[model samples]
Target: MLRASLLASVAATPFFITAATAQDYFDIGEIIVSGGLSPIEANAFGRASNVITAQEIERRGLTTVQDALRALPGVSVNGSSNSFTQVRIRGGESGHTLILIDGVEAAGGDGEYVLSGLQTANIERIEVLRGPQSVYYGSNASTGVINIITRKGAIGDTYTATLEVGAATTATAFVSRRTERGGVALSFSHLDDRGYDQSGDGGEKDGLERTTINLSGDYLLTDDWKVGFTLRGSDEEADTDPSPFGATDADSYVVDDPDEFSTRDERTASIYTEYEMMGGRLTHRLSFNKTKYKSTYSSGLPVTRESEAVKYRLSYGLDGRTVADTDHLLSLLVENKKDSSDDNPLYAREATSVALEYRGSFANGLDVQAGARFDDNTVFEDATTWNVGLSYQIPDTGVRLHASAGVGVVNPSYFELYADAYGYSGNPNLTPERNESFDIGAEFAILDGRGSFDVTYFNETLIDEITDVATGPGAFSFVNQAGKSDRQGVEVSGNIQATDALNLRLAYTYLDAKNPDGSVEIRRPRHELALGATLDTFGGRGSVSGDIRHVSGNYDSQFWQWPAPTVELPSYTTVNVAAQYELSDTITLNGRITNLFDDDAVDAWGFASRGRAAYVGISAKF
Candidate 1:
């Protein structure tokens, strides 16, 4: 009842709606990278997309990439802690989404990237493309793609530094230098937290310590040639509570254990070169990427696991004017990837792929894009995917119509194919999962272009879904489900420049996702809403921003109970506020408070969420 009332109230409010863009409301001239191999203007892109710039990240006082991603339309995030964060898009599974750092794939062996360890200190921008993107990205792109672009060299020499201290004993330091042809950046972050007991009983606090470091640099060989590299490493140690499996006392389901803790270490590196020729109309790029992940868990028996992946990619693009008032671009790509793990000898896989894409823009406000890809796998069936989209703007009406459709594929992971573990065995005969999806939307320029509103509807069907089936008591095996799972949703967003000094933004999503058996999926909220406001004060020297988010009607499984009954999680609302004041031309002071209301919303079953916290920091540029 409360959820319904809130939704109704927000819908009736004229100021509540906005598309996720840069600081402006629906800036059609903005350039985006994830839309295609080449950067394309938002006006010509057909897919539902969002862009969060570095300036916005700083204004909002967001520390991590995951924090900046929350409250976006058709996106949901949940996990037990920062070390295990998972992101789901358009009701798709966590493994169905693909993550890219400067055009390099960043997923682990399981085809999923943990966003908890990605900091925003040196990021330039984040672009999110919703819907199936396998045509260009190949496997593990059944749902969507998140592309993170880091800072690069500036036109002249410059230096920057930042220092921050916050709640939970958190500290951060960042420094960078940029020359005419190259630049380098380094950042270190640490956090020590004394968390509340998840079991709900008064007991010892669960604690955690985490540290992360990032280094990146790039150099320009010539006006049309460039080389760059990025390296990142993170280490985390957290005290964890035991699961509900085999717990005798109800209070013991999620009790903290001093002896139970986990540690994780992750490292990633990428090197790439780009060259342009044919009067700057043709371009070529080659890149190599590698990632390593290791984890150790201590809970009665100590266990450790490790995984690694390597990828090589080469691509070329040709741009020309095919028609009098039309622009065309053709792109070709070839890639090879390999994955391995220490868990089992058979847990190794490799694949090679070829892909082609085309994009065209007309002078009459019409744009078209199409792409196709083929992948050959060593241990699974070969797969093919395709996608097409278009967008049109009506002359002088301030209205734009867009639509997109695509087919995506996701291969089985190494662990799923050859795992030999306690009470669980892998299935080698499993085939790849497939998804078919489409979305249509319209954008309206309202209030004489001072505000904008957008409405989008998306539908998807997943075939050959992967799941584990019980073979006997205390035993299970991976298998492909027979039928298809369905997901559909509506996303509404808008923004209004209320005045010269204030801006308002709103977004709401309604999702209906079901399993093959017509049962509701778990951990996906049916309703999500967000409201935000920013005000510039003190003659533009000071600024303040506040945001409110509400989530409701999500479900989770109680693993402690027999048969693992599913239960609904309590609805939750959280508020965040930030303020910044410029003290000098090159110095600034900033502070923020998160979860101001301290709503204890359980995202995963039996896990206690974090409460209110505050942070303050200073930054300087020289």
Candidate 2:
């Protein structure tokens, strides 16, 4: 299995490698940073994790991060449009997952990051760590973490560019440069889609126009010091439909209104410095991150809403070998964050946190990890979280066992605490939600490392869940629930190098999510399955890959109906195929077809999904 190969490689490397330098080789997926304070090998990690390498993204012709994540186990992605995509994991709410870019928080004041705005240009790799992770990442990490790592400077100068045209009148241009000491990347994408009638009837097209820009660079100050920065911005104008606020017919809520449109602008930036000390035994890092969001709605009162978030963090790590064939790492972190919005000038929240983590690896094929964190908040009750895990490889047997348990916390979002819109009131007395979770998994290597299979079972319970309650006619307020919500699931995956020229992969998930009253949760499918195959053609100079995903047994609510009626959504299946051929040493030709069969399956009752579409593109390296 690949995990065995990764472990063997890590066992041969040095005790510690600075995080800044590790980025140079992130494509290997041998070291993972999001799972712990310090980088750890995949074999030693006790978490259910998945990685999407840059090569895979390019091979699949994925333009957005959300597209790359759609087929991953335990992950579900859906949206009404390109500007409102949401990602959920393991039956957890979208806000329960933390989004990170180069160790910087990418979420807004609402504690959620819309995945549609994140492009794949200049991305080195993506890491998904499943389970409660508040002990390592603080709030908004009640279920998992998605860490997006960008490409770093290489040994020499290099330049690359790509141009593509696709369905929906989409056009994209990307360019990047890498130097010995530093590197920079830039990308721009524009989309003008003549969307379908979202109401499932003939009507005006709900079109949309969106533009995105991403920039990043880093420079080495010295042999042991480095500085880097990233900037991302996006603008979107989307035609929306009228709600059922005052409509006489409940089913007319999804009808399109040409005059009802919304505009949004989002920006995020981060700067950081890293310095190694004590001859590489100790490392220190300092970073500052900021995100801003602005939106205007033309449906009701031409209302404008704006929010901003700022975070400052500092951390130190010490690495050493205390015993023969053993390694130990200890880390400490301190951070301060503030979230505010112009809608409520007097409503802002600040939080300070301190955390400690320890990781140990021994020659007896056992790895252990533990972490704890304490958070101080100004608006809600304080929280403390802890986690522990271990992984062991049975010697002489091709089996590995892993298990982890953790406590997670999520503070109420600013909107939930201060918003006074559409007859909904905020609840300042609401407390943070708490979660307890555990998972156990085992992996088996078969066919002499040519094939691998794994299965895991996870269980979680959430307490003090924030929910809306009706107070009076057309009035509601947020409040903590009295009972706990339960979630349990099983995940299975397999990989096989079937032949020297072909590879196959499969993943399936079975989930059971329940509300406090033991009722089925909405939007979480009970069964999801994905199958993929890749073939190397032209004697390794060209490649072709195809993927299929199926989702079934999902339910959603019709919010426009009084007392919101729970409805089951129809199952969906999507197919995508991509191929790339190397024209020369510096040029490549590529293309892809999405939704090959044009199955018009809607994730939501009133939302219409895209049909079969094809794209062609060219890329060059110099």
Candidate 3:
């Protein structure tokens, strides 16, 4: 019923009476840290999660980070080449989604992550935790978890800069400070794109380049103690178009060369410390992290290949409280990783993890969550994950109900357990790739603070799953897949503040991914939609926004489609618009238009998507 005609068109609008402020952010301070046994409220998280603040990415003029996650709700993103952007959750596998920046372990090159060079300078919000987070993020996260939070300062000193131009060219700078105790932030971003000829029969013009830097700092020794630091870096390049340009057969998608390219040289760093004495409700945190990924490939002949990966992490967290409503959290982790090529070190792995969480909060409001994890991998066996969640609260009818059950894990990378490539012989008894999931939801609240609506249903099961078995005259190995694989979905979202100056949002998803004999899952999509609105215009000094998207069309066949063919890929829609204006008190001006109606897309079945573009910018505050 298309979710009852989109909640009956948001209950037929008309709630415009203005004049009321303070009590939104979805009523009661949004907070979600993987949403389970600790930081709650993001509408009391018990399962589904999606939050993109920073004022909705500056009122939706969003620049990257996959276009602010394409308006949330079970996110799906195909390609636009930030070196091959691909992220899909709920329909899974874009390296099985798991990326965290502020919490370390920035998933990159090795696992899966390439969201269009991710440049959202000094970000300050983006938390989307949709499902089976391996009992709170442990091991490739099995389809969900993207927590990035930057910009740790705001209030006192500030500086900002921005520049934008035509078919992609952007520059940004930011500086920050906050006093009361501590804060610091710095950011830089640059992106260039000439993009848009990704084959489809055109020639050349498949460009992209990026540069980014971000940092955060903090210190506050007393008042319960604290210390922190974070750093991020990036350099990217992309230009690989050959999709159907020179393809004859061999299943229809090609890119052998034409000045091919690929590059990434990333870096991440972290340090942390936090403490609070029992009198302050016992809490602690300790951390250290490092990540470096490098990759390069060329297409000028003579084969140029380079690879590198380095990761190290150490973490600790504790939060305790045992009385009146209960609480508990304890997490410890350690990981050391490596993958290298030109200087040797082709293998190395070390791991240790532990988690235990419990949270109860009752007095009839009912809420309970449980968690467990124990992973100790050095290549295989010794894994255990768990999760359980429930949230009630229907008593007075504001309505809320939630449910969850989880288990997730993935471990087997480095070309999926070592690839020999020349002779194709590498399979170290492959393991880890387990997933089991569940979800249930409901939530509604309308017309008081304005509006809200929610829904969710999910199911998953995957086991072993490694895939690539065949050994004979043409060798092949790396096996595991021997059964179970499925995914189920339903998601609907809503929001309406409809008048204190207009705001609206919508989301939808209906998916069913498979492989237990019901194959068909390449590029995922099985219906998805997103709509948006925001307006404050003129009298409030100016603001306007727009968004629209629709997707449904997927299939590319996972290899060997020799005589099978039938790569159905045909649905698409896109529109975007944005605005901002202030021009005084420190000045501000912004603009955006992306694919405003250039519609004629393809997000993988042969790339090519991106048309009608425009952008303008100005911002200053110093």
lDDT of 3: 0.68
Clash number for model 1? 4
Instruction: Give the top-scoring candidate (lDDT).
Output: 2
Clashes of each: 4, 0, 0
Candidate 3 per-residue lDDT over residues 485-547, each given as its tens digit: 898989989999988999999998888888867777777888889999989878988798999
lDDT scores of the candidates, listed in order: 0.74, 0.75, 0.68
Write down the RMSD of candidate 1 (Cα, Å).
Answer: 7.7
lDDT of 1 by residue, 209-301 (tens): 778777777666886677777787778787777775677544566776667777777777877776656534555667677777666654443
In model 1, pairs of residues that clash are: 17-494, 18-493, 18-494, 18-495
Ranked by TM-score, the better of candidates 1 and 3 is: 1
User: Which regions in candidate 1 have their CA more than 4 angstroms from the true location?
Assistant: 1-29, 248-251, 297-326
Per-residue error at 440 for model 1, in Å?
0.5
lDDT of 2 at 362: 77
- Give the higher-lDDT candidate: 1 or 2: 2
